[model samples]
Target chain A: MAINKIVASVEEAVADVHDGAVILVGGFGNIWNAPSYLLTAISKLPVKNLTVVSNSGGFGIEIWGGVFGVHEHDVEVLHRTKQCTKHIVSAPTNPLVVNTLETRYRAGEVEVEMCAQGTLAERVRAGRAGLGGILTPTGVGIPEIQRDKPVIEIDDRKYLVEKAIKGDFALIRAHKADRWGNLVYKGTSRTFNATMAGAARVTIAEVDEIVELGELDPEAIVTPGIYVNRVVLRQ
Target chain B: MTEKFRIDDQTMALRVAKEFKDGDVVNLGIGVPTLASNFIPGDREVIFHAENGVLGYGNICTAGEGSYDLLNAGGQPVEPRPGMSILDHAESFCVIRGGWLDWTVLGGLQVSEKGDLANWMVPEKKIGTIGGAMDLAFGAKKVIVVMPHNTKNGGYKIVKECTYPITGFRCVDLVVTDIAVIEVTPEGMVLKEVAPTWTPEEVQQLTEPRLIIAPDLHEIELA
Candidate 1:
């Protein structure tokens, strides 16, 4: 069967994003990371009220990396750049995300949802499946009030039945994708991208290489074409 | 069981620390439980375990001592006392999982009259999780809860049935709150004492699910 997926440019893929949209951006720190080109599009888009879900805005060579004191320019712009009000950070709490989201939250620009590190990953899984909520007992009643909301009860035992979370779009960076939209994430980049694919309504993948459909092995496909909505190539 | 009184969080922590005889391994859950370490009296040979791969932790460290990767369950930088050993996450989990913890001090959002606990997660919070609270609750030889007697809204944390999620059922052995110190017995939450500032009736009113106070219960004083 001919692949229904077509390769589009980066901008064309994310152009439809509107203000106050929730977007899941997958990647961790200065290791195998997501494509900056996509993040650039996100930043350039300036979509307000965005809930940016990510592991880390890594420093170093990472699009989110900056060694504690690496810059020589008396003025800083990278970490200093503030996200717009519409950006909401929904993911595990980490230093990088804290710094990024803190700037926004403290500025009263965005909202933060701190999910347990493991639970945060599972949330994408739950979100994509369209489940009511996943029961894991991540938070029963740690705080009386968390961020001005009550952690309500469900069954006899307390569990934070996190509502199934879905996103407006996902900006995924994979190592390669076949023209059919079958894709594979190389090493660490696979971190949250594969899971994000399941949860996002519209997934925009920026692949390093795009090959013919059958050129890739069937077993190698981490994300099936059915889940994928669009594909684009970096080079 | 030994009984004592405390005027505030610091006093409560100190009074609980006095219960340690010697050479006991303990795990302190996040928040209020973390304070117990600071209140421990002079050298009595106590070791602390952290769920995130740390053992024999010291009190919260001051800056300029040395930069350390050691952290409590809350992920905040903590000072590992004089003789501390660092292990991997899984091994540390084993310490808790193996029931090696002699005692554990935990904070509770709500404690039912049945001794059920709800402290790890709250509603609508993306707190990211109930870290190691369950493990410590079930694994420790003695589970001690330290919290306020009543919530700010005047609702009792001690209830007939937990309105929040249950961390462990009939697992808590002792509950030490700002109001009074009580123990869980088959008969129910046996009221050990009433806070010095309040009367038994006041404590009873603050508590839902009527409490079973010990007959000889007298007000407790901190050591």
Candidate 2:
């Protein structure tokens, strides 16, 4: 049997996602890096009460369309359509605009669990690496972040113990991928996409180009095929 | 309705830029701190780090010049310089959390006499974005906050205690406002330099905390 993980379409790639699933959406609030097709497909699904973990709660597709001059969806579709019940994010609201997530959060339609960006990354990394948790000094003094969390003193410095964040699915964007799902990224597009690659049980990659196996440079692969469960080429 | 002679935003940024040393790695927050990049001295080589995963990037690109794929922490496209490296978000925070940054300039909502910082949110909004501010606040070797001395309604921002939620405890090292340059010392907030044509008494009148007058206090120097 050949090791082919490439799927036919974005809809087919996310077909197995169910209601109340934990989804890790990639990108740093930019259309170029976001898994727009997968997000659109997920938004069209009947699934409800999703838990979205990302760096931002998204500023919506229209705002990004204005910024990049492209009509692409972002994680905001989840909140706009009322599919997401909770958002575990670092930046949940944009200062310039009142995004969909903020609107929903204010209306008591959605919940938010905010974390520092670095701590969010490390938590996802810990999930992928099968670690228990991490201790850091990022939120030592803030009561809102330190509430009910255990604190340990290391070398006389207080550190908060942040738990790992694993997801049911990870929707990521990549520059290119092989049939076997070996992925490489371009520029800063690699931000959270590369970080959430293997941080979930099922990692689905939406890539710009899909090549034959062994076509990708052996030394240049940012995410090996074993970590990727499926790959779909962008339309 | 009295007209005051406060320094402008660019001049405040220039004052903050003077704190940078050659070969120093600095992370700049959004707003006024981002403006400091434009004022870095020509003779010195300062590496700029963005939380979104680019290091040693050049200046912010004008419209139609840079690609959308390359953006700073502020979500603005920036020029790609030689020796610049792009990594994933995880690796980018490693540079931040690992304490490799020599200085981090952030815009402040409020700073306490104890050097506590509260810039992430205003309590009335009921929603705040943490972003990378908490990490940058606690991780950087030296933290410098730049903002106006008072709120739009003429309320003090540099106070005896921050009423807004704190970003970091005892994290602020220095503060550069529109009217004065204040240093957060072990004893209290020290008034180090005043803006031209502004007196220390006038600055203290708007400030919430009592300021210790530095012996060598002078007018803010951009050079």
Query: Which model scores highest in lDDT?
Result: 2
DockQ of 2: 0.88
User: In angstroms, how far off is A85's CA in candidate 1?
Assistant: 19
Candidate 1 lDDT over A107-206, as tens digits, reads 5655545544334555666787877666544445534213343355666655565566678887776777876678787543455667677578888788
Instruction: Give the interface RMSD of candidate 1.
Output: 8.6
**Alpha-carbon runs more than 4 Å astray in model 1:** A1-235, B1-6, B62-66, B75-77, B124-128
User: What does candidate 2's lDDT look like per residue over A59-168, in tens digits?
Assistant: 88788678667898889999989999999999998876899998888899998998999999999999999998899899987987888889999899999999999999
What lDDT does candidate 2 reach at residue B198? 88
- lDDT string for model 2 (B1-223, tens) is 2358889988998899898888899998887787777787667788999888888888888878888788888878888888798889889899998989999999899999999999988999888988999999989999999999999999999999999999998999999999999999999999999998888899999999999999999999988
